[model samples]
Target chain A: MTKPVVLTGDRTTGPLHIGHYAGSLRNRLRFQDSHEQFLLLADMQALTDNAHDPDKVRHSLIEVTLDYLAVGIDPAKTTICLQSHLPALAELSMLYLNFVTVARLERNPTIKDEIRSRGFGRDIPAGFLCYPAAQAADITAFKATVVPVGEDQAPLIEQTNEIVRRINATAGRTLLPEAQAVIPPVGRLPGVDGKAKMSKSTGNAIALSASPDEIAAAVKAMFTDPQHLRVEDPGQVEGNVVFTYLDAFDEDRATLEHLKAQYRRGGLGDSKIKRRLEDILQALIAPIRERRAQLAKEPAYVLDVIRNGTAKARSRTEATKRDVVEGLGLFVL
Target chain B: MTKPVVLTGDRTTGPLHIGHYAGSLRNRLRFQDSHEQFLLLADMQALTDNAHDPDKVRHSLIEVTLDYLAVGIDPAKTTICLQSHLPALAELSMLYLNFVTVARLERNPTIKDEIRSRGFGRDIPAGFLCYPAAQAADITAFKATVVPVGEDQAPLIEQTNEIVRRINATAGRTLLPEAQAVIPPVGRLPGVDGKAKMSKSTGNAIALSASPDEIAAAVKAMFTDPQHLRVEDPGQVEGNVVFTYLDAFDEDRATLEHLKAQYRRGGLGDSKIKRRLEDILQALIAPIRERRAQLAKEPAYVLDVIRNGTAKARSRTEATKRDVVEGLGLFVL
Candidate 1:
């Protein structure tokens, strides 16, 4: 056979950062060579909470696209699509909605956690509640068999599987494939301020497309052990953000181990470690920043990439929809 | 300087009955000449509850269309389109979902009553809960100014207007027109069993496409005043089924008034009144039955009418969606 399809994407609510790179983007670079990859900029999903600020979502669509291109996600090998451009995804979502109950959606731990995190209380938007069904639409519309998602997003894939089984059972045919969630090896990247997660809203993220000066500043202010007060004092490596970045990005394993031992022995200074991290980050991000700057000057060409991918996406989704309509026994009229 | 648009439809769960004619179909025949009309065969909406039975919705699509044509709803003047064929309606619904909260949808009286009526309890489908948003999409997608509905369906119109205002305000432009509810003057045709409503599921309806023998059998079994036993004794015309049918269908005022007075004075028997009703119903439904039979012989021609109407509908909805995309400030990519 045929290669298994891998579907994944990020909501275009803000510019992607290194957190995204560590979590899923890095994994996609390898998966694209073996699988049929479809990367979506989920502008419609972003509107669930950011409905009042559509302009922000609109702008971030490009920002996130630039981040994807900067990270070496080849458009020729991977389809880079905008979620809202596929109207069939929305239609499939509506049909899938009939298969799930409000109670089932309410019981999803991922959505519940998100609601609590956002402090939406009892005023949760219906779109936010029903997003899993829409996500189901996105995955199954392409008949994706593998979905790359973070650990916290496991419930979303579970819900999609349920809808896939339900619709097929209702139609008495296997028209949709059940997708499996693939959690990335590096689950999360901590914020520069030592927070457990790096998020754009927290103002603690180093964006993938940051300039050299911006990267240097972010690395210099990176959080580390507060109690390692002096040049001679022992430093803790457990919760150190600088070491965490080093763990994720640094390729020299022997040098990193030697530095860790030196720091534990109470001779290495915080400034010395910060300077090392600064250099490594600049090396990683400099070329990416330059490529992004070059791509930024050609917005039309970037849009053409998305447009062409969307056309491919539409044809695939239309084929899926034809199966659904046939199973439903509805005449096209 | 142009005629306003009107949107109306039926959930294609069953064939259209005389109840439909009294409630909305009769009104549509008059409005189609003066306004642009779109009559939807809402197969998608039917699946909101009947997910397991796709065949019913699919079959009912044609049955409902035959009824519309039989009742003189001109396909030349009115667009008789299927809901599932218009993907834009679903897209609009997804966008509209962001503007309304889950709690707000839960509080909609129409949905609440439907849930209770269906005995769904806490197991209500998410699609069933979000149908008002879908209905809102259907109305605003065409920019319909008038919506013909029964008295019980008034709340559906209210919810549609709220979504329209919210979307237009959020977009910072009046891209959607607010729709007004138009309750038909002649409300309902009660069931032959004297029930308050004529429903297909209730097995008490006289279908618009019923044959002469079926019509005769249905009228012969109609419920009337049970206490009136003797031909010479006074009969009750107050809650009599025969008098109700005469009130709705019998156009000769003088003869109907005389028959009513004679029946109250005890000269007329139950059989006499039943025979009168049978004759009146046969005359009204004979041409409709004949037309439906002719149309049924040519299914391809009937399908063509729906296909052409759907194309016209698609173009109109695409124009509406363009305005929405522009207002959101999102690039096509």
Candidate 2:
């Protein structure tokens, strides 16, 4: 039996961090074994909001690729392709735009939230506003039945399905498949400061390639219960960054539960817990850092991986584009 | 010295009419000699508004191409290609969308007028709202310096120039040329009803391949001076559809002026002027109809013309896309 096709990717804005690992990459690693996976390096989508800083997107492509390699996303199992290199996606996007209304795009819950968060009022970039259609193109072009996204992003999957239904209805046949959003079991990983979600731009996250000392420093500075002034004082675990990291990274559930119980009761020091969390993190990231450093030296090999994967993706997508064009009775050359 | 490149096209929504001939095709015939011209069969643009009727757009491609050949537009001089086949245009359009804002696109007078006229309201197709960007892609992908547009469409050219400037500024060089709008000297041709502009959908248009009997019937049904009760009664020349067609088509200006004077002063009946108009139209349309009939027999040859021209266009536009991608520091595969 053929495995289900899965589409997932990162926006090439910066090197991904542990937040990406716990939230998505870890899930992607499992998908590679269980599914036919395509990992798109979404440089074009990155430009939707970062058009003025294309160099950042350009340079981050390698960094993000290295991060993927370091985290054990084997290229043999997962096809890693670049978004801008595939012309079919753009062509499909233009065609799909005619099927969706401007108001519908604006009313999309995902886009609306993003627009509000980014403070882009009426001056929103046209590409940013129309990205849902582009995303539909990407998902449908691959015929990927499964898409991994955050819970908040399920709306995007719905939008894609809406476009899928429209295209199929227009063609009088099922020309494309609707994608199901696979929400990861774990939620967002907070920054070391425990302020918000960890992101590369916020300067508070631990990259997968962080060195030994950097990992130690990030752990030392993690926020814990402020009212726990003394080692003997009872500490709250709900908002504590160190406890959160431990919850995400710790393999020994019984020992972590004991530690949490002790901390909640009394006499559990922040240093001791931070030391324990640091040990687990150091173990987690050390091999990844080494692997990333080794891969970083072979730039040509990494680019070749992208080039080969993109070529494969190009053929696959072009076939689908032709199918759609023919199904729509568009005059084909 | 290199000749300036001109970009021009007709929306493949219907066969070309006399309005299209008088308004643009005659000017295009002259442009083929003095400038390097690329004539786009704008099937993709037609989809923006006619997405519900892609079959019409598809069938009209041949009809419009036949019109071009029938009216003496030499494919050797003007590259005649299909818009949907050139992937570079779509890619460039997606790229340019990032350089402009949604509000800015909405504020474009050409788009605003079209939205109001179509009564699209907030339900405008995203593609229709963003066609100016697509048009920019069409013009700049060829690096065409001259774009033939109606006076009302000058704002679209302005929008294209804005995007050109933004792209050049982003690239830190002039990667794309700003296009100049070349408005045709003759204005819109009113319909035979003299109610509004001639249009195919309205069923008032005399197609370039109109039959002789059809031409005579259209001329006979044309609106004229309603108050001219007798041949001796004075007629109004200002709003007479026959006089308008005469001014547009009649080569003998002195004879036309004498006829107009006689009709206004008295003694020249509607039949006399109608007969003159019918004679001119039949002469003008007969050879075009015969050529159209001849060309329609060789569907393979017509398809080849589009195929060969589209292949040439694809290479040229791909080169430009590469330049823009490289100049913008986008990751190149």
Among the numbered candidates, top lDDT falls to: 2
- Tens-place lDDT per residue, model 2, B107-165, is 99999999999999999999999899999999999999999898899999999999999
Interface RMSD of each: 1.1, 0.5
| Model 1: CAPRI class | medium
> Which DockQ value does candidate 2 get?
0.88
Report the interface RMSD that candidate 1 achieves against the true structure, in angstroms: 1.1
lDDT against the true structure, per candidate, is 0.89, 0.94
Q: Write the per-residue lDDT of candidate 1 for residues B113-221, one digit (tens) a residue.
A: 9999899887999999999999999998899999998888899899999988888888888878899998888777789989887997888999998888988898888
Q: Estimated TM-score per prediction?
A: 0.97, 0.98
* Steric overlap count per candidate: 0, 0
Chain A structural similarity (TM-score) per candidate? 0.96, 0.98
Encode model 2's per-residue lDDT on A1-333: one tens digit a residue.
999999999999999999999989999999998999999999999999999999999999999999999999998999999999999999999999999999999999999999999999999999999999999999999999999998889999999999999999989999999999988887888899997768767779999999999999999888999999999999999989999988988989999999999999989999999999999999999999999999999999999989999999999999999999999999998
